[model samples]
Target chain A: MQKHFITLLFTLSLTGLNFANAYEMETTFHGVLDLRATVTDSLTGNYTQGGYGKFALNDGESFTLAQAGGEIALNWDNGLSVHAVANAYKNNGDFKLGLTEGYIKYSGLPNASGYRWQSKLGVFYPKISLENNAYAWASKNTLNSSSLNTWIGEEIRVLGNEITLTRLGRINKDPFDLSLTVSAFVNNDPAGSMLSWHGWTISNRQTLYTEKIQLPYFKARMQGYDLYEQASSSDPFLEVDDRVGGHVRAEIKFHKKGAISAGYYNNNGKPYIVDNGQYAWKTRFTHIDLTWLLPQGIVLTSQLLHGDTLMQSPLKTDVVNNDYTNGYIALSKRIKAHRITSRIERFNVKDNDKTVGDNNTERGKAFTLNYTYRLSKPWFLSTEFTWIDSYRPGRMYTNQPINLTERQLAFAARYFY
Target chain B: MFNKLPIQIKFLFISFFIIFAPSFVANATNTLTVNVVDTNQKPLENMVVYVEPIGHKVTLKNTNTLEIGQANKAFIPYISVMQLGSKVKFNNQDNITHHIYSPVGDNKFSVKIRSGQEVIKNDFNEAGEVSMGCNIHDWMSGYMLIVDTPFFAKSDKNGNTEMVIDKSGQYKVVVWHPQMTDINNRITKTINLNSAMAVTMQLSKPMDEIPSQQNEDDFDFLSDY
Candidate 1:
């Protein structure tokens, strides 16, 4: 499915690019090409091991690996649009195309609505993002060191829905910007909860989502982006393991070029959850984020996320005793045709639900720095150096903590038509 | 359901949102005249003016490097376009060098322009808007917006600019300002203009009030310049 989607998108994107939007092969491109990879050098003996799975914590082996992928969006004349994502690796994730954003939407509402009102019902992205989908480097702030079992309210979250609402604020000068989106959906695949890890979730369901709120935001030259407001509900009839709950998050950018983002979210710990209904479990999770954009394009992005877990707890089984703190500094510089990016991630994790073979608390560190040179018009090459450390406080490799630190080096080349 | 309220009240308040919403805008087609002032009623230079089409085909991309010439100590064309898939270039047209980069919007970028230097381009893949600042000069600031649609436009000194929508389509037309009245969030209305119509939108702002750029916390900008 992913391959087919990519083929269609690649053809359309290249065609669009070649003909421009003129279709006469003028190629008015309305697409995007994102290909990213890293190659690194080893520092510790056989320590570089990382992938996604219940057993990705490899015996801690050192090796070199790299991957790349991106998406292309094509807009047709009759309101039909298609977006396809492609990756260089097998099951690399993010490779599917559907009407998630294809619909014949009209601009002017019935006029009985407010100003700045417009919406699409066929398919589209929900109005949910707080840096998660904002910046490429900023998205993995918590991923660098997160344990394999932590569950977030909106972790790995997305759904198909019909929507309607408004587009508020001025692109350049509007101080108080706002957007109100209301969507309804049915028979969604339930697989994640604010109670499990990335790929965790129940399956097959129907629900409604009548989300309504006035999100007023601000963007000043001195400050980046600041949002101040509140939201009350999730989708009207959206089924989430057959449970509904309130969700919200907000943040403010300080004068010192640093930003603080925080939000409190909840979900009906539907007993059917986890225990398959034998145990009615309710859940709630809270996440706080602070990003200090220090000097020299170096970003110190940190986040503290804790949430309720369990089919039932003595107090709030949903009590989020599992706190995940992530800190990382990302520095990048573009010199000539070579772009250099260096980033190091340190994680502090503590969990209440201790799974098998897993210590209650663990500290891990990963350092990555790379350089890419756009070798030619449609090609680019990149190489990176990385270090991954899984700390075991008392154990020792020689006199050092038995903790494991794997080092790796990788290189990749890409082509964009 | 509410088709029978008094016609006067309906026109004055109730149906106001519905009546002028899908059509009339702050353009020449309307009666409102917006005089964008800097608290001083002084026409602010480099202030960007965006118009959200009611319903239309908008294009988005990332382009690093917005070029704003520096002659004196001030940044020229203070207001400019910050598209997706792109970057901004701060050229030191002045005799001396300038350490520039927005602490906010342009946080992903920074550099020192030596009299006539400029950065090639940076990345801005995702969509939305942001602000840029100069670390060396706290007072020097600029705005950068990442939009998914080409239906948006900026205004000139007379707070006027001809908004162009390539062909024909539906659009959520909104004219906004950093200091627009709290009656609501700036001014947004729906509009449908066929290609070449050249519709007139008379956008306006209330008197006695203008947002300030001083309260900014030395860097992070949540509002405007």
Candidate 2:
């Protein structure tokens, strides 16, 4: 099915290109290349390798091609457009590439009464992260994203349709603008598996559509356990239950100074349903975000998210029940070609069910400081330092310490075109 | 005899009068210089100042088409002033697309311009401020004030702008700025421009902050949010 989807996307893009030339439509292409050198003193392996570490890079020093991404947009004169983004990453000589998002959008002009309507159809990320404003969902302020946004990038993507309504302020002589967005999605029933199994992690690695993330070692995966039939890998974008999910977000923007938004998301999956080794994990969350442009070129941003997830057995028995919360505060200032940013984050997961050998409770705090200098129009140099202290009792099952403190320093060169 | 003179002599005589004619006109006309300042006494720039002759009709000069271009995902010349019934051209000079629109009544228009393309809008038949923005880039804002007369100039960095009126009697002077914290973003003063005049207009309240157009990150290549 994934292969077929890819083929369809390619066909649609090719047809759009042909129409662009024949109809004099607009077509634009953009891309970015990033390279990174990192040094870390983490005692545990990185989470990408199924370890409990809170970073994308593992212990020791390494040079890596962080990401190379390309995006294409075909725009028609009648407020219709098609967009797609593909990304590639190389770490430790291992390479992966896939599409992150592809969608068709329609943005209608404001009417006489100042009302505008817009809609999108396909696969895309929700407008949740205030940090990942750069290309390919990368953080513009820092090399490492906040824990709240990291989880969003890792597990949250919608494969459906969304509609938005906005009332522009300037048209009516008002000082504030208001917008509301609602979406219904599918193929995301297994959304909260990683947050439950691995606890919360802090990284900038966004999962590709066709990728499956490895989970940390747990006794439930062993023979003669309640979850012995569970898959070792979690497919975040799979449709285990044939049910649809929904999200609603509302935002108020005060001119160009800043904006505040609140949203609710629910993937109404049947917890007891399992298909092809993947279980339906019913998940729901509420989130709030604030971005304020303070005086003297300083910007302050914050996000708070709280949610719960549940997975049960065919016998209506509770297998995994967890409640999680994450929040972050960040400040950034730009001085000429240099930008400095600092952020603090807190994350927690509470295990409510007593599933033997599957302890998903964890608590963590993190700090990040980043400095970026613009080398030229298309080039940038950035250095970042990240420190995290986390406690997860689940690590004890693997004969590891329950509490761990990890630190990493990285320098990156990025080019945008 | 003057009409029957040699063509060279007639041309020289006409040239001499044409060269010195501006001094004669300068003596009869009045030069009005308006200076604007904020409450903190800071010189305000980009303020539009114009004078309308009361109880009289004046023929407006034919104005040229004004151009507002998009580059680096920002609108060049954030503010523009044009004569009523004149045309304005929206140009997209960047390697991207921009959807420019204005919601003002009677002057409302929306057009999507691609890279290196231009869209001409001539439906600005009303005299008012037309605020424009790119639907895609919400931070991109611009204003075009359409005045009934051509006797207007935007303030310079020193907060000074000058206009010469051929007939200087009973003129209504007005100052406008988008960020001005005043009713209708305007201040009107009725004065008799019988002689050369210098007017100083100070705002009673502080001006609102002008939003910055520069983005924190140099990610203009990104297609969507």
TM-score of each: 0.41, 0.86
Each prediction's DockQ against the real complex: 0.03, 0.33
Model 2 steric clash pairs: none
Poorest stretch of ten by lDDT in candidate 1 chain A: A200-209
Worst 10 residues of 1 chain B by lDDT: B216-225
- Which stretches of candidate 2 lie above 4 Å from their native place? A1-4, A7-23, A43-45, B1-45, B51-56, B71-76, B91-95, B114-118, B155-162, B167-223
Instruction: Write model 2 residue lDDT over B18-49, tens digit each, in one string.
Output: 99987776446788999988888888899999
Q: Evaluated with lDDT, which candidate comes out highest?
A: 2
Tens-digit lDDT string for candidate 2 (A220-308): 87898888878888888888888999999999988657899999999888999998779999999999999998999789999999999
TM-score of model 1 vs. true structure: 0.41
- Residue B72's lDDT within candidate 1 is 56
Fnat of candidate 1 is: 0.03
* CAPRI tier of model 2: acceptable
